[model samples]
Target: MTGGTSDARDRLIEGTRQLLWDRGYVGTSPTAIWKAAGVGQGSMYHHFDGKPDLVLAAEERAASEMQDQVRRILSGEGPAYDRIAAYLLKERDALRGCPIGRLAADPEIAGDATLREPVRETFVVLHECLVAAIEEGKAGGEFRDDLDAAGISYALSAVIQGGYTLARAEGSVVPFDRAVQGALELLRLATHEGR
Candidate 1:
């Protein structure tokens, strides 16, 4: 592809990412994407088969970015508990909600397998990362061996997603902060040295 064509495609993908995160699949129209990307309709069609095809590219990009961020935090130097705490405590735009997690509630996206696959896989990978961290902590005696890593991973994931929902619902970040704090406190209790 020519430099201009490549640039247009990248713009479209990025525009789709922003629109999808803010407006969802149904609400994000082709015209909106074109407008956001500053590309003409012909350019959009020339670069993509259709909105779904372009959206797949956008979702793939978003999922990859999210995975990279999580992997970096989880794999960083520290005790497993510390790494997990960092993952949970990391700053976020709580009111805006999780880019991928918000897609879970979008009827148009959730109903379509092609568009939903990346979102599903993103969460699956995140859960696996969390499970690994918990297992590592258990092995190192930072957490109890009797704890269910998979279950705790699921709980942590839920807390984060639910925190976003709660924050958005209330139009404030307090609920989200409270949810994260609660989760962190529970983790501290589970991994307490005396325990």
Candidate 2:
């Protein structure tokens, strides 16, 4: 009984995650979550107060996963340049776009202050971490001293989102790959020349 209950809850959470990814928050519903999880309405309501509650859970799941991935990539042993470059080159499915960025576009998500606050915080935290990493690289001479960590962090993020948008619009991964490659090459040049 205990295992069954846990499985059902996990299924609900995982289902919500995928559903939110596939569809924006405005498009996801408690009914959809129940159907996807193969659980009943009562079961979902038992786990969450409502859709907003469940959506928050899904967002947190997505945020935590992203944070874990970023930490792992940045933590790799080597020069900061290599680590940052490796992080840029990390493979992605290319088209679905970032989970966190997807959340940012959900109208329902933005309207809910409770939900919106954390979602905004997630990006802020991610940007801050990237900035810190870049700053560390600058100090270590792996990046240019003139590099603005804050500006570059946002630029990097914008490039990623723009790349994904371009790929989805064009229905090709070439644009996405080119964007990252171009960004990396520019970074390499800038850092090498002590930008």
TM-score of 2: 0.93
Per residue, candidate 1 scores C-alpha lDDT tens digits across 1-195 of 899999999999999999999999988999999999999999999999999999999999999999999999987788988899899989899999999998888999899998999999999989999999999899988999888999999999999999999999999999999999999888888884735
What is each predicted model's overall lDDT from 0 to 1? 0.93, 0.82
Which of the numbered candidates is closest to the native, going by highest TM-score? 1
Clashes of 2: 0
Q: What is the lDDT of residue 77 in candidate 2?
A: 71
lDDT of 2 by residue, 41-67 (tens): 899888788888888887888888888
**Residue 132, model 2: Cα distance from true site in angstroms:** 1.9
Candidate 2 deviant stretches above 4 angstroms: 193-195
TM-score of every candidate? 0.98, 0.93
Q: Per-residue lDDT for 19 in model 2?
A: 92
